[model samples]
Target: MGKKISFVSSKNRGITLDMLVVKDFFRVNDEKVEFKDVVANENAKNSLVKKGNISIRKEYCKNNTDIICVDGSIAGKLSKNAPEGKRVLIATPYDYQFKAINEYDKGAFKKKNTYKNFTHIIVGSPFEKELLKKCYNTPKSEIIDQVCIPYSWRLNQEEFKKKHYDKYCKHYPMLKGKKILAILLTGELDEDEENPYAEVNWNKIFDNLDEDWIILTNSGKLLENMTHIGYQHRNQFVYSNRTFDTREVLSFADCLVTNSGLYATYFAVRQKPIYCLKYTNCEFEKYMKRKFSNLYIKNVEDIDMTKFSEFTSENEKFCEYFSYDCGENPSAKISEIFE
Candidate 1:
């Protein structure tokens, strides 16, 4: 009999989606291999169900499974409990956030033996592999660098436009002739409740925009404030709640504006024009600025409205240095380990 693998993921959509991509690859190519999905939440379960008819479980079970493909952090916690003989595989895109770095600096992993159970660790890039080596003093032979990108990355601009443009235009008639400007906010509100974007000069930014653009925002709060009478371009903005898929909006967008995160990387890989906002001045923000030096703007007022056309032309150059290899077949590379 072939190896039986169980793919596990946390509740985070980014992690779950990447796990699904790897799972789909195995389903199509390795008919002899048996596998099951173990997701943390209902949302992840729904995503798996939407993909195809597959066996799923809420918790990880190692009884029949020869290999356990799970998230990085979760693998650490499972190490002590995992049976001695089973191979634990970690295929994750998590870019080692500030908290994890701090914990590593404090020698927390040494005390806990966090990654002791992992048989193979496959990360999205060399950057992530280096982080794992630095943090856990992991052996070079155990770690593999394979960039796991979103399945949507396979869709080119022409294909995406043909599939989604007409449907979106029908729903929002104003999107017909004008250029679509997608604004991606973190959607996190502060506890103070005064104003989340108090640092940004929103009024001056909106006033400088050309009238021919249709602004699409994911934040309802930002949308409400922008649509108020005080803003000059109130009529030009449209809001989509969490229920609406951001990828659909990104598919047809002419350009994107955001403070760095997973969505920003997605837009960058699509080779689209993106203007990055740097308000938080966090570590990740600094990393983004380093990657997109010409595209980073400290303040909203720093954006030059007239230069958007020029910016769009330089997207390929800007994204050439992007860390992840979205063009490579990560699933194929990962499957080779079993072969």
Candidate 2:
């Protein structure tokens, strides 16, 4: 059916954002999706795509003219001579970054492609749709909101302790008997080059905190010294060597705080209460936090560890805002219900 929808991502490492979206599309086991049959990069098992249960191959994209543009990168991506069957259905977040799709929609940065290509744009929010219409100069009809997001899961905190805690016990047995607080820091070096994380003393932060914490990150530069600080789950202090299950990581986090992942942002907005710090690697996120939602922070200091009600309240509002019913229907978030 639908010629086994072929999903593609721009990168071949870690948990590419697009793969997560595909997972969300399926939402359940009974409702499986025939994702694009791309092979996983040679060394991508630890990557996020693997967590999604999808396989990714190299850039063997035969330009399946019927390619789906999930993210907001311009490039009508569909060629003119390509068979009319080649359609690009993009399942994207509501926000467009630094440059608006408008920049590309208007013809090679010279003219708009709304009239040129048969591109179907699926946005997560209505506000984003409005923005697309304004920027891409496309008709409102072309911009449809499908709240249906990518792979989603309920926080099975119990499952996390059962599966991961023991592994840590072997590395740092001391960590086995303590109440822990987890602070996850998503390294932004890949996106923000100037800020090489060489100065970030993960060792110091953990040492200074009164409570025990297992810091999780993808960057390993500072992990070399986790042992010096009496970190019980020293090895539990994982750097996303390759993007292991993010939700697993998220569930593992008793207390949550992350830089800014589209998934994390979605979690934050839904009242998931992930201490969203100010200024994200992406401009659109900053726009959402500072300008759009109150859950956003100017800095880590802004968060009142004592009163977390603020985050929960904001999440409730986020749930009410769009309802995302536009994305699919009553069951758009059904997986969430079952979980």
Candidate 3:
């Protein structure tokens, strides 16, 4: 019939965000996506791609692959080695630290030639499309703003509930009947910089928060909260001490309190009442504020329950401006591009 659709992930280590979107797209189509460990193909077993199945063998992506989807890093390598197939470069700039932004920008500029090999460049937001056009001089026609969400939140809602709801309920029994304020924090430090969380007085936030609120953080620094004296509502707070599966958490969360990071983009797309905290000043956060007016918190003390309505009213306009569609089926659109 037609050319077989295949994906070539750049990484041999583990699953990348690009692969997740691919998995979600196939899953939605009710089509089988078979995975092979290229490096260990002799002993590798063919596995179906689904939620939680994220391992990719580099050898699986060979010269015969028809469609190769990759992040910006592997664009050149795939171009030089496998020039026959159509390539899709997905841009996920928000998934990096402030310091890494410049490196990524410069790298994209250097790899302008690789842009020619790619059939299209899929970007998450219009902002990313603009960045590539301005910084790398990538052609506007080749860029498609998908305005999608992360795989964690994009999985089939029914499947996610069936597979994860019981597990979440087992671990977070206290979460029932509470208004969740999912606070996603990046606790890790840059190569040489100080901890960004240190700038925010987390202890103060915890002390002022009531029992009705459940604080779930993805940052490792929140472990200190486990033993903090102000952490009186032990059941109300959870840390990133282990793998934090946020599928159920986001579903249960009434509102989201997070920094002006990638997770904030997720909340914005969901149109959830979001309170964006700016712990450290960065160009990205400044850009977010300018684009999504009055969405930023001047101070942590300003976070009140009453602001949800005002925030919700602005979400529709904000998402529209960015071309982010919370209701859009990303997999359907992505599949059209590849198939």
Candidate 4:
């Protein structure tokens, strides 16, 4: 009966400690939180209650009407379960990886949380609601596409660049200057039954970029012309080297590089010149077209340094669906939500 809420586990507690414990939602509700209706792996369920973090079993979630979801499917499921007065909210960041419709891929059921439909949906813009509509297909009356993300509080993207942008610049042997090209790259799931990655070697692409680049990755050995940075270290085009908090790396980036698709969330942070393409022999590119801001670069010659900035600045399409806002971001907005 308290401000108790239910959450769907990302991967049976596969979510890193940093993702949940360090996120804005968790931080905001520090003492005013309780997870009674929890949905997660047995290990996660046990761990939370054993640690006294949650109050009951995750299955308790099925019967409870009070719930909100960080993902779409869960929101739909909860909406189907709630009583007439009870409701659900969608609090996750949105993008191409998330569909406008409920898509249960091979592993989707495990993460599904929504029941019928949410009473009200929260989003960053009408654009986000439009994307959600692509999935939920509900009338506009049920959705609330509000600017709720708080990117300002996270860290400065510019600071991130200053801290490590030049660390190995000379050593990496790439051209450098304020007019730099930083590309953050990601890909959609591999669907090719015969060949994955389409034999398109990434090293081949990075080798040809006549500009300084940092390939951020959680793993894959320290890369050259690329920053093999981790998730927390990732945000805008740059951030304060002294701190992980994000500022304006995106909007200010001269050139941005990424292999990420809409499934990845870094793009939601700030706007910068961005370069991305679909993985060969996959439906990823088809989905990327939904955003319409990405460039499909097939060869080294197709890579245009000048256009990187152009893409980031022009990509206002994604601005709509992102909601999982962070930063010193929206302290006022957040207070109002709880108010």
List lDDT for all candidates, in order.
Answer: 0.57, 0.44, 0.53, 0.40
In model 2, the worst 10-residue window by lDDT is 53-62
Clash count of each predicted structure:
0, 27, 2, 65
Least lDDT summed over 10 consecutive residues: which range in candidate 1?
50-59
TM-score, per-candidate, Cα-based: 0.69, 0.55, 0.67, 0.55
- lDDT winner between 2 and 3, please give it: 3
144-258, model 3: which lDDT tens digit per residue? 6654644423632556544564566567777666667766654345568654444455556656566677776666544443565354667776664355556345554567766
Give the per-residue Cα lDDT of candidate 2 at 174: 51
Best by TM-score: 1
Relative to the unseen true structure, what is the C-alpha lDDT of residue 316 in candidate 4, on a scale of 0 to 100?
47
Q: How close is candidate 2 to the true structure, as a TM-score?
A: 0.55
lDDT of 2 by residue, 1-339 (tens): 323445544434333444554445454553543555443433346657544423222223323444444442223333344444333434444334323543443443543443224345545555455545555544422444545343322223255346765664454465565533334544355554544334444544544444444445443544544445444435435555454544444444444554444445344323344555543355544544544466565544343444432346555555444224322431234223222
List residue ranges in candidate 1 displaced over 4 A.
1-3, 10-15, 27-35, 41-70, 77-122, 140-148, 155-161, 198-203, 228-235, 278-283, 289-298, 301-303, 308-318, 321-325
What's the CA error at residue 326 for candidate 2, in Å? Answer: 11
Writing each residue's lDDT as its tens digit, candidate 1 over 48-92 gives: 653332222213433333454544433343424445444445433
Q: Candidate 3, overall lDDT?
A: 0.53
At residue 284, candidate 1 shows an lDDT of: 48
Cα deviation of 160, candidate 3, in Å? 2.9
